[model samples]
Target chain A: MSLNDPVDDETLLEVRDLQKHFKVDEGLISSLLRAMTGSESDYVHAVDGVTFDLKRGETLGLAGESGCGKTTTGMSLVKLHEATDGSIRFRGTDLTDANEEEMVQFRQNAQMIFQDPFESLNPRMTVYDTIAEPLRIHDIRNETARVRRALEFAELQPPDQYFDQYPHELSGGQRQRVAIARALVLDPDFIVADEPVSMLDVSLRAGVLSLMERMTEEFDLSVVYISHDLSLLRHMCDRLAIMYMGKIVEKGPTEDVIEHPQHPYTRSLINAVPVPDPGVGRERVELAGEVGDAIDVPSGCRFHGRCSEYIGDICETEDPPLEAKADFDGSQKVACHLYEPAEGVDSTRVDDVTDTTAPDDSAASAND
Target chain B: MATQDEPSIFADLDDSTVDESEEQVNRWKRNLRLWRETLGEQWRMLTNDLLVKLAMVTMAFFMAVAIFAPFIAPHQPLNRQYETDAELIIADWVDPMFIDSESVYVLGTTAEGFDIFSQLIYGSRAALLVGLLAAVFTAGIGTLVGLTAGYYGGKIDDTLMRIVDFLYGMPLLPTVIILVALLGPSLWNIIFAIIVLQWRSTARVIRSQALSLRERPFVKAAQVAGASDWHIISRHLAPNVLPMSFLYGAFAIAWAILAEAGVSFIGLGDPNRVSWGTMLQSSRAYAALDFGVWWWFVPPGICIGLVVISGFLIGRGYEEITNPELR
Candidate 1:
């Protein structure tokens, strides 16, 4: 995706070809030697090329396993990590090239909720100061009243009770609430909640998620929820986008992606989640290899190395673009060679697909 | 849905509601209460350590001597009496009243008849002045360098850290002495030299902390909250790194005191000042070690050792607070 794509009138954020690559710092002597030798520095392509769009009051789930760059994509939305390349057009302004003045305006409108509440809230700042900080930064008046309202909004009753309390004094749930309050105090139009309840107790997860749901509705906010937890994503997100090694392999409505995952990577991920009923047996397509280092990502298809249904040389030689398959509806997009258009009728590819479909067609072809 | 109505486990923790009446309390009383609530625990932890308690007592005593030196010392530190020396009297342990009824020297006098006790009392003022002032300046410079290096890391971090490495490579004492000699011998010059030499260690330590602190989620959250680089460094990064700054500041005091002593002992100290190092230097020149004029040299040597040790003990005590893993 690039800036040439048409934007919808309701779109709140349009990220196109976003990429963030971090330089691998090989110690002092090695770097110096490399510099002297005129060797190119190596980079870890954490987020290779991510593109997505969110409309007003929409919650898009970014689901991937750990180290898949979902968090990096989330952070880049708020300009916490400047995109090494590509454009993040929030509202009408391109955030990647925003100046200080524009960045301040953007920052006032977009906020982020981090994954770990323990580490996200400043330990030294009181709950009141934590919530009041953004107000003070924006030069908004009546900080005390807004902070108190935010506290009450987060369901911490009697708002004043938490004013003087520090992060260490609060429980995990309460700390997350304060973090949410801080994010909401600005009355931002957009928010990126990066696994907001991942670090909390399982018992308290629902409360926090429900609070976030209420905040999104009441404040009319656009949210991007990034998580590795598929169950949580299914529960909270309206649409789901599955990521694999810094690239979005599949994206569609949440229920469609969950029930009818098209990509091999997404299929493996869904199969990996255990079923509670012992009587119902499910086939597990165990992937072959572990996730490779981002410094040297696999060529062709990033997931081809671990794919169970390795079809032909095409999967090894040609990278597949993310597009809607000929068979599936246009809303669901998948990046896999198996779903290529019918016009490219190679005999070897046809034979391979038939052979692969013989055993698993009953279970895998249910959506078809 | 039933669980939603149930009182949360945290309901009991909500008892300490903010009292509206307390807002009307006097500022002095409020500040005092604030201090007790915030710093009182750390102070209690420090005092609980026996070594830190001893260090605090020793430091307090030295500070008292420095502050009340004029009223406490019986004679002026620079006063000398050469008139009674013609008799070729080697030494007398008697009070100064015997020779001159109006004068009193508790620890007798030096070879030039300068008052030993008065010099010892007055010397602490210079030692502490250099130590405390150098410490404050070193920590300030170190914090700024570290905060800048850690926050804007990349070429800026590389350049600042390389400078720290260069400073770290120099031999501290000789380098400080050379700089002090070039700057001219004075208390401010010595403090300046000590600051230049000692700040690198604090800078390096704080930079590593800032390196980690800048990556912390809270700092990133602060960045997302519209904080500028200056705002993030001063408000988020600096406060988190402050306890470490203070911890290094204590160690910087010890280093500066020793550096000042080394400079003064080499005869580069301020000529007009009566520092403990100058006292030892003058006594050495007069061959007090061989002549057994213990009063002239021993007090200054012991005083230097006591103050440096006190500073180290306090620093060690603070280490536990900053890094609980050390405890």
Candidate 2:
């Protein structure tokens, strides 16, 4: 649903048409070479036209491979990287237009949990100071009590032992716990957790994830959980959005999307996840080519080059709008020409083969 | 398989009975253990190096003497009336037991009849002050400029780096000479000359370090925390850049002291002050080297060597502390 719908669900954050482009400059000699070769200058579209909503008390998993704009999207949410073009609305307030003073207030309500716990934490600072930093910056007067409460909430108990420990003294899991404690110390409602456990060891990853899950429920936190792992996303995220080359390819309820992925890229990602059953072997749907450069993305559908079920001419000529998939609940949306009846696929016939629950009427209407 | 199964049996039992307090205690114990381990590692590195220990002791001694030089010296090195013209030429050459010649000039006299021992003691004050002042000024300005340029890479970086390049290409000694010529011969002018000529080297080094440090995830974390640019630069960036700045500052002081001495020897220093450089200058001018007056020049030269060596040792010790790979 478009954000214009006057629904009152306390939408904590809304990002629309977010774009970040980095200009690549060729050296003098390289420019001369390019001039001779007639090569055009280029720009990397790090986050191209990303739009999403984060309702209060809901976790939205933004799933994507490396360089797929997930981290860029997270960074833009906090205004760490300025958006080239977009509107980021928080509590119906446009953060994109927020000045320095306004941003400081916004930061008090919104915080971030970084990817690598080892590197994200300041090695020089003790755990107490790291957690206390936000309290000090935001001018939360009751410093000691707030820090103690935050440490307690993060499941780092006794608080006294950890208060004096530096980041290097803590293990990977402990460090991640400290990072979480630091984020929660501000008592923020919304948080962007950017691949928070990706750098931890496999054995320790679950502990961090569980702690996050507990913290999310305990604090009533709305989080944008960014990761490349589909299994973890399915477990933690209420809703899921799969990204490819800086664009959202598919989005739906976590279980719905995982069980019946509509987009080819989403299907490939789901199938790629290793199942626990060693006996039940499934064919790995390996896409033909590598992801295209974000600097110069291919024309029409960005995934056309790597899409398995590409039509003869339609996929190359027209960019597909993100419309409701045929025979699925209106909750699910996919951006692909293959789902459109106008592209020579019959709505009823396609719906019959694809195991989608909703009727094809909405899909057909969107196509028309 | 049996051993693994046995562990799982214990794990299940442990999971069921896991007390939250016990878990907390375990985490605390583990962190404390790790801290102790890292401390041990650092201690091992410190104790294993004989040169570092020797250097530390030497620096401590030099700093102690430099701090207390005023109280320990018998006569004020700057006092001219205590040194008479008669004592300057005749005292050492005339008698074997000239203890009573002219009011406690124990190390004999300069051409101007200044006590050589008193000058050596008080000379450290000027050398140390000028060296420290110039070092601090150069390091502070260089670090600020370097961090800003390197961390926020763009046209600003390009421009500042170009300035660094231009300064780096100029011969440091000649540039100092020209500046001193323009400013006239004085202690302040020498300090200014040293700071202007030496800051570029530190700027280049700090800039390269900042370039690498900016990419560190901690910096990115600071950004995500909604910290203002100034806060991040001062609080986060400056601390990481400080150890290197300190190391550079120590080396810069050594060079500044040497340069000051060179200028003073050439009569570009304070004319009235009885510095080691002035002693060397006057000794040479009076042909103490041509005559058999070894005591006239040897003490000042040795003092200069001691200062340079002590500075070098301190710098070496600091380098070892900051560089984990070497440690």
Candidate 3:
């Protein structure tokens, strides 16, 4: 319901200042080498300062290019990756601070569906064993009835046909359905789907997406759909959040964000989607800039180095707080120096509706 | 063609055009082709390599010799039938299919005038038993330890791996011989010794294999599904880890058999039981290497070589099947 943990009673899950940092070179030899080099600041800031909320039965898309930490954000919510810092209140219970036992209890309520269906399902297990796994783990229904119900839930009709079948015997779509069945069989309240349809064939993508959309409504499940594909996100998500360098840059209602992307990074992401028809050519904003390394995130706004609206030193020195703008709907929030009232800029005079085109001279393009 | 309307390209053709009476004649050809394709894939997977087939055949031969020793053997392994010159008498090697004289020893006699052929046959059962049982227990212990170590990882993995390393660094065969000698020979003592030494190799191999399997997303998926540690190891990790562990387990059988021979040759084996090793040890003129007495040592020695060779073959076949990189 809210991207930055807004004060609202309807919000079912609220994440604030979430971060998942991993230490590099932990092995003895690697540590020795690192110690000699004095590279103590060897932390991979995988997900930093990410905040959001999901209302009950809402589908919020966490969109980002690869290595932008959308997957990490989704994973951290389910306590798959231990959060380095921050808090996640799932309907008022703190998920970020929970220990292993507590997380196991959290796991029953929240589940994750991974990207690669082929890699996610155990190759050795039969379809029944695979789907029956979660049910057995949580000490749920009778094995026979549970497996059949899960099989039916995932749209694998006539459970007897699939009961003894192994993953290698099935097609990619069926395998993904098995993965979904494994996730959904437990009947969790929240689901984090990390590029669930990305690895699927283009033709099969719709079927899987529609099945998930149908599951969200059928189960009344609050879902976080993480994907790099904006078009896919547009179809699947009610609200969308675009991530850049381990932080959410812009987020709002899917239609509102697609129409009026407040952040330059969000606009560039929307512009990057290749038009299907060869005949039609829209005015495209080509983002020719070095994507910043997440490890060495730029001091100010991480996007300032490549921002199309190349403002003064304020963009480089100060990080902009996410604030509501009047030009678009009041609900959408963006964190950019150009949109918000900041040092050295009169916010009222700034053109809020114009295209923030990349300048002709490429000097301001990310040199990092 | 339809009148004015086009016939759909996607429409199925009439069966008469593709499936005529000629199909009956070609049925055998079709069946043969299908069989060949299936066999081709299987052959590449398990038997295309000459060594694997040789291993399989060798194992089969040894198994048959052990299992049917009583029916096949002409002379009793422990009985000496000679009235005089019992040590010097060598039975003329007779064809196995046609042995008329019970007095004529096939493949000559041992130092005690007991038939070498009979001893070789009786000896095979012990070799096979020690080799296989040792292999089974070794792999079982190794897989269990490796699974726990890999799945639980951290202090448990470190402690178990350290124990493995401690065992690994020892002079294995000599230590085993000394231990077996102390424990005293019988089939079980030798087997116990072999298992203790052999399992480390298997455990190390399986542990490394399981370590890799632990990181696979399927394992993590199970972890997230709230599957307990035991469940994840047994269901998700164990299946992928099984083949490699079996590969090492198979090879361990060969080594265990060889080690049994070595211990038995050192006079540490139960002399009451005749094995390939004991036969080698008890052979007349075996240590002296005398002339015109080739039969004294050659049969049992050859049997030992064959058994070890068979074990290697079987082990390697398992390796080829289990290893993905080789495939």
Indicate the fraction of true inter-chain contacts that candidate 3 also forms.
0.42
* Per-residue lDDT of model 1, residues A276-363, tens digit only: 8899788877888799779988876788889877776666656666555566644566767776443343323311211111221122
iRMS per model in Å: 9.3, 13.5, 16.6
TM-score of each: 0.86, 0.84, 0.79
**Which docking category, incorrect, acceptable, medium or high, applies to candidate 2?**
incorrect
lDDT string for model 3 (A205-316, tens) is: 8888888988888777789999989998899888988888888888788988988777888888888888889998776776778888767778777888888776777667
Q: Write the per-residue lDDT of candidate 2 for residues B1-327, one digit (tens) a residue.
A: 012322111122233344556645755785587668756865565556776567557656656767898888876776553324664533332111155464456666666655677788877777887788988988898998899898888899999989988888888667777787899877788789889888887888888988987777677766656667787787777877887888889888888888888888887777766677877888888887887666778988887887777777777777787786765
Q: Give the root-mean-square deviation of each candidate in angstroms.
A: 7.4, 9.1, 11.5
Which residue pairs show collisions in model 3? A1-A55, A3-A52
The Cα local distance difference test for each model comes to 0.81, 0.75, 0.75
C-alpha lDDT (0 to 100) for residue A71 of candidate 2: 90
Maximum-DockQ candidate: 1
Better of 1 and 2 by DockQ: 1
In candidate 3, residue B15 scores what lDDT?
28
Backbone N/Cα/C clashes per model: 0, 1, 2
Kindly list the per-residue Cα lDDT of model 2 for residues A24-55, writing each as its tens digit.
87788988988899978788988877777788
Winner on lDDT (1 vs 3)? 1
